[model samples]
Every structure is written in C-alpha cells, then in structure tokens.
Target: MGQVSDRRRIVISGCSSGGKSTLLDELTRRGFRTVEEPGRNIVREALATGSDALPWVNPEAFVRKAIEYASESLEAVRELNEPVFFDRSSIDALAHFERLSIRTPSDLKMLGEACLYASPVFFAPPWHALYEQDDERPLPFNEAVREYDWLRLAYPKRGYAIIDLPRVSVAARADFMLRTLGLPLSKAP
Candidate 1:
C-alpha cells in the first residue's frame, strides 16, 4: 500500500513529563497534520490562573479537563482525510485512571476502543536525564516509569503495535517516526 493508503491514526504517549510534546512538534514539522496536547494547555491555564496547583491535589479535575480535550482532539483526527498524529491521546488519559487510582467510565473506554490508530507508537520513556518540572507538575521519576509501563501494555490487547522510542536528539527521533510511518521528511526541530 502507498503511505497514504497505509495511513492510520498515530498516538505518541508516555509519562506526564515524557517527550510527547517534542514528538508532536516533530510530526507536524514533517508535513503530517497533528493534534496538539490540549491537556497540557488546560493544565497550564489552570496553573496560570492558580486554580490547580498540585497535580495530586485535584487530579480528578485535571483528568476531567484532559478527557474533554482528548475527545475533541480525537474527533478532529477522525474527521480528517489524512493521517494525523496525537501527542497524548485519551488512552494515555485512561492510563491516568490507574496512575491516579480513578476508575474509567465505560463510555470513555469504548471511545478508546473504537478509535482507528496506527501501529508502533513512538513512546518516550521517563528520562531522568531529560525529565524536569515546573510548578503545575510534580511527578517523580519512578511514578513516570510506572505510567510508561501502563501505556506500553494497554494498547496491545486492542491490537495497536508499540514502537519503543529511545532517548535521542529530537531531530533523530523525529526522523525515526517519519521513516516508520512511511512519511516524507520536512524541517526538523
């Protein structure tokens, strides 16, 4: 099949401070339409407004906002005629169900199960070398690793392939995703 014919939705996920944003930037730069992480934007706004400080303090609220954003993000992708990249899809949010000890609603689980996606995600591990934090985020390194594990397994039972992404320069990792997705290259950032 041609690259376009082989097209499927791609989701790049990892822990909270994982390189999801970095990967999203790469994919968009490579000429593929991409859906940015609305959850991050929401959390940033919340923190900026001082509505939510600690991710642990009001995880339920934060997760709810993220779920709403993810639904919108996925709908936009599903409506597209071209392959799209999602920085952190709702499945990642579902993982948070475990990460935060919250139970996922049946409808949300169904949404994740129904969405069409690409094989072999580009997942960024929790890198102590690269992981840092700002005020709104305070997840420790071990917690991030635990989240990473949850992500790596949850999709496979649903038939999506996993592509483990190692820590590398942003340029190289982007190049890897483009090649794996059978997409042409564009500017690398």
Candidate 2:
C-alpha cells in the first residue's frame, strides 16, 4: 500500500474529552469530508448489545474492533479526491495497544505501517475544564492527560509531526486547523 501524498487525510486525535469530535464537526460544517470516531461507535454498539468489546471490559477486543473500523474507513476514502478529515486513525489504536502493553496483532501492525496517515497530525491537548464523562467515554481527566502524552510520543516516532492545537474556542480551533493545512477558511454564515 502506498502512502497518501495529499495532506487532506488529516487526523485530529488526542485525549478523550479534548473536543476532537467537536472539531471534526466544525470542519465538516465547513465542507470537509470526515470519518467519525470508530471507537465511540464501537462503544455504543457494545453498550447496546451488552458485549465485552469495550475499552474497560475487553480492551484487546476493543482495539481489534477499532483497528478494523479505522482500516475500513481508510479504504473507503481511498478513491476520494477531496481532502478527507479523519477523527482518528489506526495510529490511535496502536497507541492504545502500547498503553495497555498489549501485543499488537501482526495484521494491525502491518496496516499501520503500510497505510500511514497524512503527516503533521493535529493534536488536541487535554482540556481539564472541558473534560466530561459520558456513556461512551469512560476515560477520566487524568488518564486523558496521560493518553495525550502517549499520543504525542507515538505519532512523532512514526514519522508524523504532532501539531499541538492551541487551547481556544471551538471555532478558533477549527480555523486554526484549516489554516494550518493552507486551506481557505470558511466563514460562518
């Protein structure tokens, strides 16, 4: 598999409750195509079925599902010409495996190594004040910080630059991301 040369396949990843979903929504509202977070959707599905494929319950299963989700999304967008924003990608799954000290499956590692994301990933740092828990997100605020640190290290080690997004309003953050990509900013109507 060849790496995507276009920087449009952006990955906005960070700790839980760091406004990744919100930022992705803002970008989508500005007319950017996006791939939603597969982990959250998997969590929702697990909750609905009372399955053990959850971050807190069976983390390995959760990681496997997440990688599969991310891989499918990546493949689905392969034919698109427009720059598509990914809420998270396989890298996040790898990070999770590393965090848990779980051995990453060979297939998952191969996928991650082959299909690298667009460089200079936009990282949403942990926001203490904005951190909140919900049904899908069981990660606590402190753990979110630790996750951010892990991601910061993980992405760079994989040859991707981590662009730390400033702690600002959601709109500003959205604008910052577009500007960082050298894309024209869409004005709010």
Per-residue alpha-carbon lDDT of model 1 for 115-149, expressed as tens digits? 55677766777778788776655667887788788
Measured against the true structure, the TM-scores of the candidates, in listed sequence, are 0.82, 0.92
lDDT of each: 0.71, 0.85
Off by over 4 Å in 2: 1-7, 187-189
RMSD of each: 3.2, 3.8
**What are the per-residue Cα lDDT tens digits for candidate 2 across 37-135?**
988899999999999999889988888888888888888888887678888888888888898899988987887666568888998888888899898
Scored by Cα lDDT, where does model 2 land? 0.85
Candidate 1, run of 10 with poorest lDDT: 1-10
How many collisions between residues are there in candidate 1? 1
Roughly what TM-score does model 1 have, to 2 decimal places?
0.82
Superposition-based RMSD of candidate 1 using all C-alpha atoms, in angstroms = 3.2
